[model samples]
Target: MKTKLFFVLIFTTFQLLVNGQGRYYKAQMHCHTTNSDGGYSPVDLVNKYKDKGYEIMFITDHNFLTDSVYVPGVLCIPSEEITFKRHMNGFFLSKNIMPDENFTCQQAIDSVIAQGGLIQLNHYFPGPFTDDNWEVGAPEIISFQNGPHMLEIWNTGTETVQTHDDKSIWDAVLTAGKVVWGSATDDFHPSVSEALEFNKGWNMIWLDTLTKEAVYNALLNGKFYASTGVEITEYQVNDYGTYKSINISSSNANKIKFWGPGHQVLQEVNGSSASFILQSHSYVRIELINEGILGMSNTYAWTQPVFLNNPLHMADNKNDIPYIQLYPNPNYGMATIDIKSRQAGNLKLDILTLEGKFITNVANEYIDKNNYQFLFDISPMPSGFYLLKVEFNDVSKTLIFEKI
Candidate 1:
């Protein structure tokens, strides 16, 4: 019997890890049904946003793709809503993207990037029956030059009919270098009442797999976060050597601003949980707020702005770390890892493949640990994305889970 395989084979070059344990998916990318004026009927708006919890629905009906009604557990995604004068919302669609009243919003964003689809800039301020005006901003027309993956920035029907919250045209197109990523919909129209656009604005996707290519690869890699009711269960980011630490939990937020660039706030925390550091920055993003309770006027949550000089991506930030936990997290197979070590001599977890490959060794030796917990079955593995690496002495960590 010869079975000597020590294991530690992480071949390089695929790093874009940002682990904070996975599974978030509560998406609703834009709305409108009856194929246009949207009152309901595309399986009753996917059974009213999957009975209010919404796993993921990108119906986006307006110009085409023709909603082929399919709802069972929900994950729709074939979108289109292109208005030539200015208003767009196309997602991973492969065809049928009609828009041409002499089309020009960069020709409907190059006809939704030539039909492969990914456009989204809906309601860039224009609704008072549209003569177009938001103090004539958004560079006053024809200025999405190229960037286009998102920018609804809260358009619950233009903030419930023209209160307008384009997030200052998404910080004037991210101070004009144009990265584009920020969305919050519920542009729902049943004449706006499923209690005024069910859940108001949403996209909290941090995908593993509910498909539609993992929800457009988590909206093409910005991961995601954009809410209205405020619920960011836990988020952690850390990188030290000069500073950059951010943590957030969220009871319903009391305040947790830390934006950047023109939306500028840098830091402000009042706390259901917040950690804040950031010495210098290029991009930041996090704004929890929550102020409205009895009067109901303020409630937000948005995060997707982390670029302190993005050389591809690395932020799973664990430096001098230990204090890991992973439970339920969409894990139907089994998971319950808890570690709090401070001085454990040897430990090694490893298990990968969220495109990084190498998978095995759930643990190794000598854990005279300072608090540890286990149990990791993953029911015979075989689901979708995964990653978990622990290591001890020189410290290293990661979680990113998902089995169901």
Candidate 2:
């Protein structure tokens, strides 16, 4: 019914230290209010979702910010749906913003970033009768090079009308190695009694506290799963030395399907829950399907892909430790390594091939705390992808970069 907007990327490491800190919470990150086109007021909308068992909700009124609004039992995140040629939901905004009369997709995205908000590209798939349906590709918001933080893989509103399935678009971005994540939204505008569109979709966020900051951190770390109806009790991925494996448990799921890079089904298991040896792939996510339930059909649960980064040989570094960033990423031999170390140590920087073969010990020096930058030249090596490893004492981190 509306134009397209953008979000998605998985840039964090997968080392979660679940030392009994976070708990799972139900969240409806996107929804409208009477502030825009929805029937309920902000307070009523929050109360409605709270009654439906949602612990967190974002108002996301079109062109308006609900920053001053609060609901007694639910967390009200300051968000707004920026309506333009394409529509996008900007979350965790420092302040509210309205779209320009002729706002382009990129401009909207830049606006969100300017305000330190995480943006989700809204529904890209429109119904057949809609002006911007699937036949007309979403060119303005398509590229993953500087795309939004996430994409709506399954939208309840779209599902209600039986149009705009975006699995194909999601797979294309994943195949291109963009490191994006998927989200399912209610996009609710009708009354809760209208079960077909109102509480049909949601995000199950894994966090320790029921605070806005906690939710933001979890989302940033890709620590949540999306569902239309099915409930995921547990989802885990562990490396058992030589091989990795994944285990999943869901409520009433008829089947669990594991997908690889190219929309390929790597494995499928029957029943409500199952586990499998993790296959070799750039990314992996599970799709749970169930028969009709609660006047809704084709129940589904989608997990964010487990993006693999090289593991640390020891325990994960404390959360407070600073991370390193490699810039001039696709450089012609010369590059910069920016370090913001929390602790001082003897630093050993080296380059290695993807096969674990040693390339060269680029730098070995005693480094201080705080911010530091080091430059390395790989002019002697051929153009290709390689790992840049920074080791300090017993802790080490690795980053993949390309030489052009």
Candidate 3:
């Protein structure tokens, strides 16, 4: 009886650990097909992602959803990438919303929302010179739009451009205290021969089951993480009175990072791999640093930050923390501010317009005991760039914000 009881206890503990670790599955949420502007057909792209061990694929064409394709062992989600002049992609779209080059960016967002589709600001920051030109020409037009469900924080094919622009757009939306998620896509336009390799930009999503409903619902609830190469070993959220702590662990990774607009590196311990304890800062990210010979890195841009408000300050501190970790200059409207230490203490958060007008002030609140987070509120302020100043523990950090 004693021996049997010992075995049972050990087995139960093992099961609990396995359950706590969570599961990771490789998937590709963004791809193209001949149905729109891509070179490959839906069937071919599905085969490609499957061949790459991707359990799921979302074929987002330039303005159309291909007829559903049923394949064994792989899930193909019918979706479209509404290709406006600025380009916004929607996954799990009810129907195709064609892009009109003549329509403004806001109009495009509205159209996608109307279609019962989740909208993502697709590669809006950097792309060809034409894209950059479009953004500059319509800075106000683009900045005026506020709420979006998600943003393509990274695209493997456009890594160079994505790295810079994603941060910019994320910071902008975060500063506004909006609930926005981040996603990664292959955005592949593969040739017939390359169809097998088309899903190289696949992101691994962690879900409870392998069903279309489960995957889509997980994404909507921000239950998954995105990745190109590295896989997440563990992720969870721990809520404290004044701050939320996000703990993440990865496998075969050289570095793990938590980056967004207002990024504050809480704890970075380097080893065969690394471990970090990030103070919740209103962003979703799980990155694995590549220690490969070529120094190439694999990143996982997962769900957005889930905000847990402190009931004591819910009314006064209603704004979610801003994404305050990007550049340019003279932010007049909203901005991100990073706080580095985790020790809980009185923190004074302030924002001022570039022209020297005081915008907001929140005083004497406890921060994370180990890590700090960014804070911004600009709902009442007028348009223009501004400066963000955070005062805590006799230390001051400031950043720039632009208002449109």
Candidate 4:
């Protein structure tokens, strides 16, 4: 079944999709209140965070749901900490989830997904000085299906006692072929006067508006960076069909580092600006460190990740995919997919959501021809963005076009 077909993938940074059009808004994904085990009420927490210049927060009290409310200039969403043996958090929730007896971590993760909420494994890695042990390590985390969308890489509530960086765990998960984004939070449990677990950790989300859907989309697509203090001033990523590189600059960072799989420090710079070429590694995420501010330390910011090769995959992708182009991209009507293959094999082309959910099939055939061009009417599909997956034999590539 020969048909017009295919596309090639050129991976780029998050900024390309939203670089000049949008700005970053401060967010707190985890926090507690009197609903569970915190000192402040929902209203009080919202007011305090607004005063701190925060634009968004998910009030995650233990097993208790806080309805979405808007303070003068702040947006609060429904969230909760599923107080299980190994803790978990569900944000942007629509229902209150309660874990019953014999309920497992995978089950809890699915419970959040069932409600269309964003889930994360909270403070899984144990610090060297702490004796607390839970199934929060990568060994068990990678075993779950439909697992968390994010991980609490830096949680001040536990780091105050169990001081450890969860990046090692993040690398392990990425190495195991799982895609879990990194997140940071204050885990606020004290009053402003107590001064503990307040305004210490947060995320900067990229968007043009401050609304529930905007915030949810940013998080759902990894369009945010976890941070303690360091701020990102400028970031850009450029990738042609064959070459790719990324550059970032910040005012507060003393050192800029790019980390790869297995906690490998691929590149490090001493100054506030840095650039890295994405050539061989499967993926690399940026880290910014400012030793201290106001005689204090632990200020850092972590970008989600910029991948040369996607980690959440079935087989180790090879360098065999042919370079091709799709014209009239971000099309409203007619669009064409051209597959220029040198060797003959079975080919399959698909359109999918960025998260890899299949939307429609474009072509599937045994290709004996060198060139297959597909002209399909794209107006039938919705106007949102999606991915173009081209699979030729065992080698496949997902080309990320931010504007579908």
Best by TM-score: 4
Candidate 4 to truth, TM: 0.72
Score each candidate by Cα lDDT: 0.65, 0.68, 0.52, 0.73
State which candidate, 1 or 3, has the greater lDDT: 1
Ranking by lDDT: 4, 2, 1, 3
TM-score of each: 0.31, 0.70, 0.62, 0.72
RMSD value for candidate 4:
9.0
lDDT digits (tens) for residues 24-87 of candidate 3: 5677766777887677677876886677787887777777866487778888766777665666
lDDT (Cα, tens digit) per residue for candidate 1, span 285-322: 77887876553578788887765544221111122454
Window of ten residues with lowest summed lDDT in model 3: 5-14
- What tens-digit string does per-residue lDDT give for candidate 4 at 19-109? 7688999998888888998988889888999898898989998889898566878888788998777778887666688887677788787
User: What is the C-alpha lDDT profile of model 2 across 163-234, one tens digit per residue?
Assistant: 334576666566555545688988888734366778888998898778765776577556788888798877
CA displacement after TM-score superposition, residue 271 of candidate 1 (Å):
42
Best by lDDT: 4
Q: For candidate 3, what is the TM-score?
A: 0.62
Clashing pairs in 1: 33-38
| Ranking of candidates on TM-score, top first | 4, 2, 3, 1
Using TM-score as the measure, name the better of candidate 2 and candidate 4: 4
